[model samples]
Target: MTTPPYDGQPQFPPGQPGQYPAGQPGQFQPQGYNPYGQAGQGQGGYGYGYAPPGQLAGWPIRVGASILDSLIISIPPIVGVIVALVIDGDQDELGPGGGIAMVTGFAVGFAVWVWNRLIQQGRTGQSFGKKLTGLRVVHAQSGQLIGLGSNLGREICAQIFNQLCILNVIWPLWDDKQQTWHDKVVNDIVIRL
Candidate 1:
């Protein structure tokens, strides 16, 4: 049979697999066209990148996680209180042993809370509460797991502010970045997983 002329152009140039023509859909655009340059770099004109602005965890979810964490961390103290009540029995005041038990309970609870919230969360980017809530705490700039320092600052400083000032926790509700005061201090963000 006589051969026919192939008049149509090939979909891709020879040897350029997976590459599309300029201005074509699915083609990679140059840097200038990118709305956000790099993952950790600052946004268009805003501050540091620290997780994408839109991907931040909402106030309600964050609050829920906080509540769950509070409950989990309070167990030790609650047990201590029960023990104190048992020891005190009919006495109007807590006995020495009961007082000690209560203090010990609070100390142990604080330690456990710090371990999970500061150390484990810093290393893994999630705590029991965060894991359950499908949220994570990550470095603001890199969006990577936070380090011990950041975790400590976040848990101690930021958390204290949230606890003391109701507005600190509520700030995220109206804040543009959706960050709690603590998040800003540690340069971390609670993001939905």
Candidate 2:
């Protein structure tokens, strides 16, 4: 029988239709050059493992959305405190440390929960809140999936305005790339759905 040409389409040689080249090695073709010319890999140009779709948002825009989300979630706990007051619980007798403790507990617990969710989602391909809101996180350095530490750092910084609750939210409003302190630390970003 005769072997078919490699250019047009795949055809079996002689009697076969799906046979490969007899001596061709396993798949190892070099990658084609990217069309977009940007910074070098170390400077932020696309390289290994970079997604085809690019990022979801710059740090500032993400911060805005996060601040918006935090306002929504934080309402419940505030309501709980308000309800306690409406019931006429002794405010002074609640103990001097009660407010501090509550703040600490909520901050710590919430941070930990957000961190775990972000890391898990990032590692598994979806941050908890991001999953609900239709967003995601990706690595900046390696361009592979990011982990908990970077994600936690990113989340904390992402909501700096929410955390500060007075004026930090406006910081991103002026930022050119909209990066908050956390994103600068972890070199990551949040993308939307």
In TM-score terms, which candidate is top? 1
lDDT of 2 by residue, 1-193 (tens): 3322322322223223322232222111112211133335321432232221233454454545455555655655665455445454666654445555456546655665554456465575454445565556655333345676666666666566457664444544555333455555676544454
Candidate 1 on 108-183: residue-level lDDT in tens? 8999898889888988888888889988887655556788888888878766896789888788888756778888
Q: Please give the clash total of every predicted structure, in order.
A: 1, 6
Global lDDT of each model? Answer: 0.68, 0.46
TM-score of each: 0.72, 0.47
Off by over 4 Å in 2: 1-52, 58-64, 86-92, 95-129, 156-178
